[model samples]
Each structure stands twice: as C-alpha cells, then as structure tokens.
Target: MSSLLEITWTDPVTSRKGYVVIDTLVRGLASGGLRLRDGCTLDEVRGLAQGMTRKESLVYDPADRYLPLGGGKGGIDIDPGDPEAPEVLRRFLAAVRPIVKEQWNTGEDFGLRQETLDKVAADLGLASTVEAVFAILPDADAARQRLAEAFAVNVDGLCLADLVGGYGVAQACLVTAERMGLDHERVTAVVQGFGSIGGAVARYLAAAGVRVIAVADRDGLIRNDAGLDVELLLGARDGLGVIDRAVLRPGDRTGPREAWLDVPCDLLVPAAMSYVITEADTSRITARVVVEGANMPTLPEAEAALVTRGIPVVPDFLANVMTNAWWWWIVFGDIEPTAASSYSKIDSTMRRLVEAVSVEADRTGRTLRACALQLARRNAEAVTERAGVTG
Candidate 1:
C-alpha cells in the first residue's frame, strides 16, 4: 500500500535527516512511533509505518470501542547517545509539530524513550504526543486522565505501560510453544536486544518457566547455560537498553555481539534494530522458531531462508501488538486503567491472535507473515468500510 503522505526534512543546524510517513488514515488520524538511531532512513520509517497499519488492523474487533486508526511513523538520523541528540530531536519534533497537532500520533521506538518524546512535545507546546487522537475521542479529558493513570500503574517494579508490549511478545512465544508441542520448562530462548521490549520479553518468559540462556545488547552478548538471572539483568539495564558489565554473574559467559545468532536455543527473538538477520546470517540460526520482538527485524530474504529450513516465524505486528493496542483500549473504554484488567485483557487477546495466525498458516501451508498479512488486510478493509472511508 502506498503511503498517503511522506515528508523528509533536513535539519538546518546539523543537516541531519528526519522522515515521516503517514501510511494510511482513519478518521483523519494515524498512529505509530518515532525512532532515533544513527542509521535510520526514510525507507525504514516507511516500512515501519506499513507495519503499524498491519498491527492496528490485526487488533481490530467490531465489538470494541477502539476502532483501529491508520499507521504513521517518524524517524530521525542521529545517534541517541550523541551529545547533540536532544537538540536534533527538538528540531525534528518542532519541524513536524503541525503534523503532530493535526493527524499523526507518535510515541517512542528503538533508540527513543517516552519521557524524552513527552518532554520535547511539551516543549513545543503540544498537549500530548497523542493529542491528535483526542480530536476524535468522545471525552478527551477523561481519556487523558485514564491514559495517565494507566501509565502510572506499576507492576513488579516496572511500569505497566512498558511491560504490556513485551508481555504480549512472551505470550506469543508461549502460544507458539504449545502449538509446537514443546515443554515450556525445557525450552530455551536467545533474545537479541535488551531494551524495553527485549527486557520485558526476557522477564515474562523467565517467569513462565522458559530458560532464557542468552541475551545480546549493544555492547555484547551475555550467556548462561542454565538460565541468566532475568530480574537482575533487567534492573541493571540503562535507558539505552545496554546492561552494565559489572552486573555479570560468576557463571555468566560474555561473547562478541556478532555471536548472537550462533547460540543454540529453542526460540530466537530479535528485539533490536531492523534487518539484523540477513540471508547469510540465517545459515547460523539453530532455533526452531524465530519470534520477532522488534519491528522489521528480519529481512525478507532471511525469512525466506528460515522458511526453507522449516523454522516458524511469528510476525512482529501480531507478536508486539500490546503496547499500541493497550493505549487505545484504555482511551476507548474497552478496558479500565488497572493492572489486573489490562493484564487479563492483553493475555486473552494476544493468545487469540497467536492461535488465529497459527491455524491460518497451517491450513494454507504458507508462511506465518503471509497468513497474517492476509488477515490484516481483510480486517483493514472492513475497518475502512466501517469508518466510511475509501482508500
């Protein structure tokens, strides 16, 4: 699908590039996340926007009040660790303020954080990063309050807002395990990336009896034959998702970052940057399944190679749909802003989605992504029809 609109801006001061892609629109609004990374490109942001459309459609339910909005994404090319990162982000946000105010609702992704986005948005005098959706909400004030309350709810020392997406990713892993007839306790996982999504996925999978044997961050890889201490590592992570080397346990093994795909495990989750797994890298994959915890983490050729090897891959849109859906579920009154309620809803919904995708894939003898895209497109059409829009 072609994007409805695309913008590329070059920063005046640093000449850095920033991009926005509004892939589709429903009720005059679209939603996705803004990412900051050293090598971010317009094409990457465009693909992410398309993924957001699929994610929004895959979560659609006629019974729910949260009608899925279309997909949009923003990206800026600057290392988040750079000293000038804040100013670059400020200028990028300022450059796109009009779009944010009118139609695009974006939050943090990849190298970006929610607090940083919020601060910048506020600095630009915007009411909220997602204020665009408020225009269509029945009661904007109530939604604002409810969303704030939901974000404030803490679970197990981590914010509920941060845990929801990774919780869904873990749920997808568990569901996939059940379908493959594997014992969850004996299954091992190797997760690439230790950021919010990766950290949370590791935590929840560990809690569910899965032994996460290896986890890779930007610095290097941490491995333990038995199982790494997920809680300790999660607490030790910095804002950029890098773990402190001082926190390594006596039994833990450290290796080069390039060795992530070499680790033998039952499930492999790439939760880091996009396209890390190339066609050549697929040769080293020993996992039975590849669950994408990051958006567009695997290249098409790599996925095709995995398919030839009979490794099932759970697409990113379905696996990591929780965070985006959670916000809408709360804002649209389909769910209350409480931990119990949110957890219950997310679990049931994610389980249903995973099962649906698996069954469809088996029935049609197709890749999981193909079946999922079919489902998403059908639902998207229905959603568009219901919204009285044509695209």
Candidate 2:
C-alpha cells in the first residue's frame, strides 16, 4: 500500500524529466511532505508515506473528533540549485494539479521554499502534511467561521507552523531521556541536519539545557565537546541548513564526513534524509537513545540492531506527531487556538504520549516502531469498523 502513484512528467518548456509519488490514501484523503532533492526516488517517497500513515493514526488524546487520515508523500528529482526553479515549480504544480485535491494534499519538505507552496495555492490547491492543510489558506479562521455560519464544509485558513513537527520531536526526546533517568540538562546530543526540523530540535534541546555536541549540515559536521551553541549555529546556517564553518570556535569542526555515526553522546537524532543510518552504522552508534527526526532515517536492519543491543530507538512516526494534534484541533477543536496555545498544548501532550509509548515498549519488549504501529493500526481499524456499522 506504500506506492499508490508513480508518475513521470516531462516538462513542456525544457522537456526535462520529473516525478511524483503518492504513497497511500485513506477515506479519499492522502497527504504528506513533498521534497525536492537529487536522486530522490519513488521508493523513498513510499517509505516516508508509510511513516505518515502511522503518524495520522497515532492519536494522543483519542477525542471523538479525531480520525485517521491516509498517508501520502511526494518528491521531485532535480537539482535544487537550478536557476529556473520557478519554472520547475510551475511545471510540477501543473503536472500534479489534476490528481491533487481534497483527496491529495501536499506540503513542503526538503529543498522546497514556502514560496513554492504559495505557487500551489495560486493554482487553487492546498498543502497537507501531518496537520490540517487548510492552515496555509488565506484567513483560515474566517473561512472556517463563514462555513460554520453557512452549515458548510469549508476549511479556509486552516494553518500550521513551521516548527510544529520539530517541536514534537524534541518533546519525544525529552520524554525518552526522562524515562531513561538521564539528566536532561546535561544530555549530550548529536543532531544531523540543520533545516527547520533539525534546527528546532537543537534549539528546543539546547534551551532545555542539552548540550548539542555535534551538528551535521550540508556543508560539513561541526562538533564541540563543550556542546555547540544551538543559537550560534542557527545564526550561522543557511536556508538549507548548511553551516558556516568559519563562524565556529577553534577545534570544534569535524569537517565533512568524519564518522558522525560513531560520536559518543546521550542522544543521536537523524533529522536529515532517509537511509542515512543503516545496519553498518549500528556498530558506530554510541548513543543511549536514537530519536528519529526524519522519515525512514533508519533501515530495518539498523533498527533491529539497536533493539538487540537494548538501545531504545524512538521511531519517526511516534516521535514526530506534533502536527497530528494540531490538525485535530484545526478540524475538531471546539474553538481555534492561537499559534502559541496550540504549540503549548501539543508539547505537553507529546511528552505524555511518549512516556506512555516508552512504558508500553518496555512492557511488550518491542521497539518503539512496533508499539506505535500496533497501536495506530489497532485504533484506526477500530474506528473504521465502527463507522461501517449500520444505524
């Protein structure tokens, strides 16, 4: 069910090749992030969608308003640095326009800018990641209130924050650290990737007193035993999360590709791309815990190795469900919550959910991935079955 669509598109202007992948759909809706990267493939999109599926169903509060949504992911294979990026985006939107809608909503991932999403909206479309896709629309609340007055279904102005996903991941890490009895203020963490998600995780953890010892960006890996300053690093990074090595303190640079996997720390967060951590990387994984910040960052074999080695690996779907809660509020909350209120709500709930997940994983002696999957599917199926009953 991972691959629902694999379409190859030829640009009408440049005759360049492009692709789109729809991983899965549920109840006529499918949604996930759309990434642009060199060598990106349908298989990678499919795997990411699978995690999104789990995320859509991994309910923390289980209120009556929530329901599991289908998972869908999209990606385009292209040089992200192409000068004709606008044309590329236009072509992509045109190609995907026919198939994307209430049934298929997509949003930004790596190598994509918010302007691209604006382009999509200009074409009369929406973006749905783990949260309500309508949040990106103009005046989301007015649209919703108008629809409510009309007794209609209009999701105008449903919106999401850029850091919602990363915020959830940080909370998950904190929960894991707390459950393991690790001192949060003294935790040594290595974060791979400096984009929105990675930067947010680093900032959240660093603010909470975790020492971010290593940060691997597009340019290179930077390390500081005294803990790299997350704020300083964020200030020095580019939009793509590439670090300005020149801004670093002396003797704090790991340079490019210098064994990021073997760095000893209390936490290792793979927030970059998929398959970054594989079976071979396990032997080098010295962290007490690994919290996924990216979809499918760890291969099955690598996860198995961690489980066998008794290291708790917080699965991606479980660790990154912040947007799901937000979506629930967007569609189901009695009243709309402000950005700050929504984040505060998600943060507190995320910690509790992760704690529950960790406790259950220990009780079942299974990986966080397994526990999350079992619970998500179980809950989704139950709701599905209930809806099918005759009145």
Candidate 3:
C-alpha cells in the first residue's frame, strides 16, 4: 500500500481550518509556501506540494546527500484582496499558529504578504527561530517583521531575475538560432507580461540587441517597431506590475490587450499567468521560441501544439526553479565561505541547471519537460531510498 498522505491543521483561535500537504519528508523536514487565495483548494495545494518535491529533487541532485525534505504546502480559501481581509487572515493564523510552530514550515505565496504573516506570528507567539524560505525570524514579532521585509525584498529584487532569466532565454534563443541557421540580427521578441520577470527579460533581451517589438500587461498591449523603452515602461509600471494605461500613447497603442499574441516576433515569452497560451491562442502564436517565465504558463495541450509546429519551448519548471533554490540556500544558511563567492555560486548553479536541461533535451531528442522530470525522478528515488534506511 502507498503511504497515506497527511494534511493537518486547525484554527485554535477561531476554529477555522487550514491544512499542510506533506508530499514527501525524507529529509529532516518539509518546506513550502502558504497561499491565501479565494480559489485555492485542497487538491491544488496537494498538486503544488508534489511539484515542490519534484523541484527540490531536481535542484539538489548528486550534491551533498540531503534526504528528501518532503514537499509541503498550505493555503486558505479567502479573498485576500477584500478590505477586511487582514482581520480574516489574523483569525486564520490564530487557529494554525501552533501547527506552524511544530512540524510544517510555511512561507508566503500568492495573495499572501509579509506584514500579515508577521501579525500571525506575533499572535501565535512563534519565536524568531522559525525560518521561512528566505530569512530567519528571531522571535514571533521579529518573524512577523522579517516576513514583511522578506516580501519587500522579494518584490524589490524582482528586477534581478529579469535579466537573469532573460539572459538565459536570449542565450537559448541564440543557440537555437545558430542551430537552425537563422539570422540573429533579425530576431524580434514579444513579452506577454510587464511584471518584474517579463519586464526584466524584455530589458535584457533588448540590451543584447534583440528587438522587443511588443509588450503587454493586464491593462493593455504596447508595440513599436523601433522598440519600446524598457526602462521607461518599467518606471511607469504599477505596484502590481501593470503598466499604466495612460502611458500608452496613440502611436504605441495596439488594437487590444490580446494584440500582443498576434505581434510577429522570433521569441514569445509568457511571464504573466498560468494557462495564457490555451488551445485558442496556440493557433495565433508566430514565435519560433517560447520561454515560460511563469509557473505552468502553457497548458499541456498548448505545449503540444507548439511542439507540433516545431517551436522550441523552454519549460517553466526548469527555468523558474532556480529562484526557489537560491532562496532555500539563503534561508538554510548554506552559503560559501565568502559573500562574493556565494553570489557567484548561485549564478553558476542557475546557469549550469539551465544548460544541463538544454543539453539533455538535445541529447535524448526529448522535450525539456521530459528531461526535467527524468532528472527530478532520479533524485527523488535516491532520496526515497535514503529515507527508508534512516526512518
């Protein structure tokens, strides 16, 4: 029989409920984020937890023999955007504080913030010793503040990965261009999200001399043959990463929000949300390369259609896991001897991971998704074996 999946938590204060899905726990503990969104469901949490397990395995493979830490995730189905949402969150945390103190580690996810996490930690009297994926909180109150600060830091650093992933994508595109004997100078790109990752990618690609002909966000799409000023667009971008509609001058304006998809380009990156490239949109994509910057931005069917068209796709799970790995190392205090050395280590690791995926895909004639899964499974199996001996 398979091991039973266990998810347990409660609201001691208000009797409201939350849950922790422990996907695997071979290492000393499991780790994942806490999401508070209205549409979050138990099944969704379980799937995400499983993905976390896979991500951990993929990143830590063939390194030090760290047992699988197990994948864990928790969430509350609440509208975090609501005005009185803070109070609701407080109650939710009051009920689950004890659980957070004990076995299940939680961090911020979508629709959740550090300020609110800090408040929850304070209410539960969780000590500062409790660490999230980013930093260590010295006490409950400090943890609360740290959570907030960590979140701020995450948002602030959003621009950092912009160049990192963009550079990687550009490098990948360059490689693909070389292999296909395509003209690199003529390559144009469209960024389908103006958020940090999307905007950063656009900037980095433009800097590398790739013409970013189009960019879009929640409000609208902007296009210019001469290329839009990435820095200026970023300056005008709002907190939610949406570009202000007022900035879209008549010359820069596209027909509608969906016009971004139809913009002819050599590369198209969906960095905004999941399932953006659905079946209906797949027929319209003209890009030769698609790099996913968001988590699961393309549905399986859409991905298949792209594959059928011979369009190379860089898988989202492979491309985005580096950020999580970096945060994990920082939170775990697993830095190198020197600060500069540590930063270099992280960069090297990310580059190597991306290269490895690309190489494996080429070698085996398999998709990046297949290669990443194979790598993850190999590591997970090893972790599972170690757990059997140790547990």
Q: Choose the strongest candidate by TM-score.
A: 1
True-structure lDDT of candidate 3: 0.63
lDDT winner, 1 or 2? 1
CA lDDT scores, all candidates in order: 0.92, 0.71, 0.63
Residue-level lDDT for 168 in candidate 3: 44
User: What's the candidate order when arranged by decreasing lDDT?
Assistant: 1, 2, 3
Between which residue pairs do clashes occur in model 2?
A: 134-158, 135-158, 135-159, 140-156, 140-157
Better of 2 and 3 by lDDT: 2
In the order shown, what is each candidate's alpha-carbon RMSD?
Answer: 0.9, 5.3, 5.2
CA lDDT for candidate 1: 0.92
Model 1 spans with C-alpha error above 4 angstroms: none
How many residue pairs clash in each candidate at the backbone level? 0, 5, 8
- TM-score of each model, in listed order: 0.98, 0.86, 0.76
For model 2, residues 78-173, the per-residue Cα lDDT tens digits are: 667777656776777667776665455666777886556655556654432222434434565754553233222222222235566677888888
Candidate 2 CA-lDDT value: 0.71
Stretches of candidate 2 off by over 4 Å are 2-6, 12-19, 64-66, 123-160, 324-328, 331-337, 386-391
Question: Would you list the clashing residue pairs of candidate 1?
Answer: none
- Backbone collision tally, model 2: 5
Give, for candidate 3, the lowest lDDT window spanning 10 residues. Answer: 128-137
